[model samples]
Target chain A: MRVLVAEDDRSSRMVTRRLLERLGHEVAVAEDGEEAWLQITSGEVFDVIISDWLMPRLDGHRLCQRIRRRENDHAVSYTYLILLTAMTDREHMLAGFEAGTDDFLSKPVDEAELVARLRVGERIMKLEQSLEAQVGELRTANEKLHADLQAAAMVQDSILPRNLPRDKRVSFGWEYLPCEQLAGDILNVIPINPDLYGVYLLDVSGHGVAAALKSVMISRVLSNDPLGSLLLGETPEESVTSPSRVLALLNERYPIDENSSDVSFFTIVYGLLDARKGTFRYANAGHPPVMVLRNGATELGKVGGPAIGMIDNWKFDEEEIQLDDSTRVYIYSDGIIENPNEEGEQFGYDRLAELIAGLGMCSTSRGATVVAGEARAWNPTEEIDDDVSVLVFGGDE
Target chain B: MSKSYPAIDQERLSAVSGGDREFEKELMEAFLEDAQLRVSQITEALQRQDTEALRSAAHTLKGAARNVGAAAIANVVMKIEEAASENELPGSDLLGEMTGEIARLVDQVRSSGT
Candidate 1:
């Protein structure tokens, strides 16, 4: 073991150094506390410090205190500080304890006793060093794990739609906020033809990764299915001619209890729009009611049928609306109207209707902006518990 | 009359030294230096609200104290580390007491003659 010897007395310092050397230990001599402090602070490594309690230019007590005050970056290395003191008074011992001395040897030190003390210091240091190394490794591993989780979050966000199609004949807008790194709400607008478009919005039953994965699965299914063919036709009237048929197909294929018997059903609103005819053929599967605004008048479209994937043969209600030249339609998930404030009062459909009615006086773009802004303001401090999504269509050319 | 100072426990010391006196010495010096450096690092970490660094410094100090047979100091260091890791400062009194203990230890070691 390498030892740091701090002392003012030349003879005592030499004797200590020779004794340590004879014990097969390397020794570094510090003439006083100040010198020892300097050596330690210089980033030199030592196994133990055998320091005298009294000396010129900083004493053993001060050195021990400084050593104790030193910060440790890695694992603990045992630096045993043995205070060489003549003071045997109980009060003096108490003072030594206060000064951070690990052990004490009275004046006219015995070689055997000194050697034994050094040996003890050596043993303790090794134990601490190993423990510290293990701890450092564990800490590093934890940091890496945290970093990996964050990277996964970024990948999840990348899968979400970035931009929506913008046209003068029809306007499209949406808002999405994930409760966590991933969410269950999925919305997409797919163009089937020049004059025909399919707008789909789905909300899974729960939140987090499981629900998010399901929503993604549903999105993939819709993207690859033959549903796009239904939107393509010469006349606007032919587009989405059967809203109930689409629901029936989905319900048959993706039964909720097939994978799990739990409540795995989802609320979906699928609409086929014809730009030329200014009309929409839509089906609502136990989802939130859609809102229609025509020339500053707002009306809630009725909820059509049971949620898809709930039962094997659930019938759906098809709805059609002829949009006026200045008409605007709003469709959304239940998260919006069902959001509750600190007072436990939900921002119910009634309140939503009022907001739409008030904002309907302006252009579709402005109205959508106002509604989103107001909803956020309602609960500025608290987090939105569920995913909030909004889609607005029909703007003047 | 021969002065019979307490006999140093060679076996315990060797065990603590991991059978490497040079390595033990190096480790001890490194720990002291690190502990000193950590004081400033702790201050910076606290100022910047770096909980990770604060926790790390406290943990290191605690371990080093135990190795050097400073059990009381180790206990205090452990408390500080726990508080810092949990992102709570605990109380000013505890911090003050720890600082006082460390300062006194440094003073004693400084005064001791080789």
Candidate 2:
């Protein structure tokens, strides 16, 4: 190890340097605290320092204070300081400890005691070095994970409905807010034909990467090529598959494994909208009710069984609604109504419907965005813990 | 001819010097020069009645004297330091005692040619 000896007296400095060198350590001599401070601040890292108590410019205690301050400010490596003090009183020892001296050596240092103290310093420095290395590695790993999540978020965003289908008779709008880097909520619109469109909003059971992966997989299947054939019928001549059958097909595909410990499931609202005819046929599988906006908000209540994947081979009921020119339909995830304020009161279903009804005849997109914002604002912290998704269509006027 | 001061521990000096005659001689010479410089500084401070300077110089000399195993000189300087620390001026008699101990240690170091 490299050691520094700071003594105003030449004889003591020479003696310390000689003793340290004899112990197979490289030694540097400083006439006083000022010289030692210069070498320390100028980027010469030393393992141990033996400093005299009283010196001209800077004293040993004050020098130790400055070293400790720099160590905290810049997070420099640790340097074990041994104050060479003749003041062995309890008061003086406490003062030296307050100044951050690691140990104390008498004015006439003992060679055996010096060797043992240096060994302790070496052990402490080695532990610090290894801990620093581990922290560096963990930081690198965390950064890589963050970058990967950002990339995944971007991919999920790309799959959403960027450009809604253009129709003077039917308009579509949606808002998706993810509380974390990855969200379990996903929604999309599938154009089955010129007259018909398939729309869906799905929320997996939980909120993070596991739930998000399942949502993404479901989204890929829903938006896969030949979606019209997949959703409507096996052939073009066959009639369109009802919303209930489509949901049943989905439930069968994502059934929960009874043998495994994971009982994960999802809730969804899938609908087939006849844009030309103003007819919406939808099935809700343990999801929040669909809000139909006319004079006031009306809820298309639950019609299906439990949430999809919870039970195998369960049958679901379908509901159909006839919308007029002034009707706007909204299907949303449970995150909107379940979000609680600071008072521990959830933004309930009634509050959500009243808030949307107050918007009156606003455009579908503006209404969706406003409701999403209001739901977020309901929480005092404004930190949503669940993924929020809202899909609106059928703005005929 | 070899000479020794009763207050100076020869064994302690030999241990510090690692039984090297040249190194022991070098240590004694360095201690002598530092002690002389500090002794004069103490004398001036005493003449001026500067308790702070007297305490500080005495402290330095005390440390160097202890390093050279001159306990008699170290003990005398320590008393001077303690007196000044208490804001009490060292009288002529105490000053004379400190100087006398320093002089004896210096003489013994010079006479003993390593």
Candidate 3:
């Protein structure tokens, strides 16, 4: 190890230098406290500083203090400060520790003792250097992991519907909020035929990465021919006309597993709206009830059976409602009602029903505006926990 | 004439040693060499207008001096380093006094040949 020897006397400096050299240590000589300080601060690395207590222009105690202060001064290694002191008083020793002296060498210094102290200083310096290097590597790894997670989130978001179709007959609006990097809610508005439309809202059992992956799987399955037909309960002849059977078939096909004990099931409300027939036929598998507003009156559509995937061979009942010129239907997942406020109260179903009723009393065109307003009012200051989906359909004038 | 020894001021030596020859020699050596190096660096740092370097150099020198029993030199270096670090130089007379003390110590050591 390279050591710095700070002594004011020529003979003493020489003798100390000889001692350190004999121990196979590199020694740098400083005539006084001030010079030793400069040598150490000059971007030079010194493992230990063997300094005198008394010197011209900066004595040993002050020198040790200065060296301690410089320990964190640069990007280089650590420096151990050893104070050579003649004063062995308890109070003085305390003062030396306060000044940041790592160790003390009593005057006149013992050769063996000095060597042993240097060895300790050298070992500590090596340990500190290794620790610092490890910390830097860990920081780099953390940054890379964060970047990868961000990239995955972007890909997940890209799989969602970009924009719902805009037509005079139907008004579509939706909101998606993820509690983490990914969300479990998935909504899609796909045109099954020229005059037929398929609209569904699905909420996976949980939030975050696992739920998001399941949502993507459901999306893929729904997009396929056989699974799509099965999920929609499409028959060879009546498949295009009825959406209720599609949901029933989905429940029958993929029953919820009871023995596995995993909280991984989804609730969905899917409907097939016929523009020419002025009718909406839907299948509800234990999802939030849909709302039908007509002539300033609101009614909640009943769910036909238990939620999809909850039980095998669950019969899904179908509900058909003829929408008059002044009628509108609203469908949503449970997230909006489940939103909690700072008061710990959920934006319950009652509030949602009231908001729908109030909007029906007002006008059909203001349906979207009223629903959003009510949700905000329910939890004005809190963040929404899940996704919100609202679809409004108006009949021909 | 064992190595033509300088007339040892027994009283002064004993005063510094506390009845230890090795302690006296170590104290004298640490004081002279540490003081001179620190003072020289301080002078150079001041000439270069490097406030940080000047302060640090002076501070280390001060601590080292105080450690081995040179309180007077430590006090001077502490003041210099602090002033330089704060961008304030002490008066020329004070600096001269410190340098003069350093010279006297060096001369005393050289003549004594301890």
Candidate 4:
């Protein structure tokens, strides 16, 4: 153990130093409490300190208080303090403890008692130091985990379609929020032909790493690239896919087994729009109800079926709605309506119908932002409880 | 310097010395030099008529004096410290007496070392 003896008197300091050195410990000397404070705070580590109760510039009580504050900084280890005092009254001892003193010894210190007390303090300090090191290791590991997750999230964002195929007649807008670092929701825009465009919104069954990996796989197959994915035709000249065949092809590729505990599925709504004729054709899986805005609000729920990747050889029904210059359609995942407010009341279809009616005059991107803002405001925590996705497809004004 | 002051607690000093004659002599020499410095500080504070300074100087001297087993000097300085802290301290009379005793002890330790 390394010991520091702080005293205003030269003789007491020398005597204390000689006694401690005789006990097989390294000794550091301080002329007064102020010097002791400087040595301790200047990054010189010591295991035990024997400070006089009364000092000129600083005192034992103040030194103990400052040492206790250093304990809050995890980088520093605990130091055992033993204050030497000539006054041994009960009231004074109580005051010493209140100022963070660990132990006390009377003046004219006996050599045996001083050695014994230092050994006890050293043992305690060793235990505390090991515990502090363990905590530091855990803190460093936690920081690494957070950084890795953030990098994964950035990679996922890079794969998303940056800008939709430039079209003069229609505009596309969307909002995506993940409850964790990786989201289960994925949306994309693909150019099917010069006049037709395909838009898809898919939500995996669960959240976190597995669902995020599955989403990346599904996005690759649905993306506009034809050379790598199985969904496209062999010739580069004919790679675009039809809207109804999109879900059917994904159902065949996405694996499913009832016996497997990890078997999962996803919901989807794939739409094809013809800007020249104002025609919209779509295939809906087990997702949220799609709204068609024209003279008034109307939900197209007749073309609904089970989520994709769940049934084999199940023919998915396709429906088409003739769009007009005033027509704008909305397709989203179950995340929006399923969100519960503080009163446990859900933001249901009726409320969403009312919201879409009010947003009839806004642009597609502005409308998506407004809808997401209203849904989050309905909850007390202002948190989207699940992976939220909103896609609004509308005609240009 | 005089020998009228009370004798130091030899038993306490011996326990600290651990029967080492050379170590005892070194400690006594250091104590005497330190005591002289403290005596001057108390005398200066009394001349300045600063009660707070008197309280602080006496209090520090009390603890250091006691550490060398000088019970008589420690006792008198302790009284002055307590009284001055409460602002009821006596004047130069008490300060002179304590400084005189401390000076005499310094000389006694010096002669004994020879």
User: Which predicted model would earn the best lDDT?
Assistant: 2
| Candidate 2 fraction of reference contacts recovered | 0.60
Better of 1 and 4 by DockQ: 4
Q: CA lDDT of A76 in candidate 1? A: 38
After superposition on all C-alphas, the RMSD of every candidate to the true structure, in Å, is: 16.3, 3.4, 9.9, 5.4
TM-score of each: 0.54, 0.88, 0.60, 0.75
| Residue pairs of candidate 2 with colliding backbone atoms | none
Candidate 1 ranges beyond 4 A from true positions: A1-163, A166-168, A178-180, A204-214, A224-267, A285-287, A294-299, A304-316, A338-346, A382-386, A395-397, B1-114
lDDT of every model, 2 decimals: 0.69, 0.83, 0.69, 0.77
Q: Write the per-residue lDDT of candidate 2 for residues B32-55, one digit (tens) a residue.
A: 887888989998998899999999
Writing each residue's lDDT as its tens digit, candidate 1 over A1-397 gives 8789886644345446655776789899998999998998888878788777766789888888778767444423546678877568999788888877778876544567877887778778878788778888999997885666555445545655687666667767766665543457777777766776788788888655566666766776555245444333325555443567767777876677765644566888888777778788888888888888777677888757878887778888778878766677888777778777778777887888889877764665566566666665666656776777777777553
**Candidate 3 per-residue C-alpha lDDT over B39-77 given as tens digits, one digit per residue, 9 for 90 to 100:** 778778778877787877776665555444444555666
Residue-level lDDT of model 4, residues A1-397, one tens digit each, is: 8899998778788778878877888999998888998999888999998898877799888988888888766457788889998778999899899988889977777787897888789888888888888889998987886776676666667766677666778888887766654667888777766887777888888655567777787878776575565335545676555556777777777757678765668898887788888777888878776877776665655587778877876678888887766777887777778878998999888888899888885788877777876776777584565777788877786
Q: lDDT tens digits, residues A273-366, model 3? A: 7766777788887788888877867788975567777777666777887866778787777767887777988888778777776666344335
Candidate 2, superposed: residue stretches over 4 Å from native: A88-99, A227-242, A255-265, B1-5, B91-96
Scored against the true structure, residue A127 in model 1 reaches a CA lDDT of 83
Rank all candidate structures by their DockQ, best first, as comma-separated numbers.
2, 4, 3, 1
After best superposition, candidate 2 residue B44: deviation in angstroms? 1.3
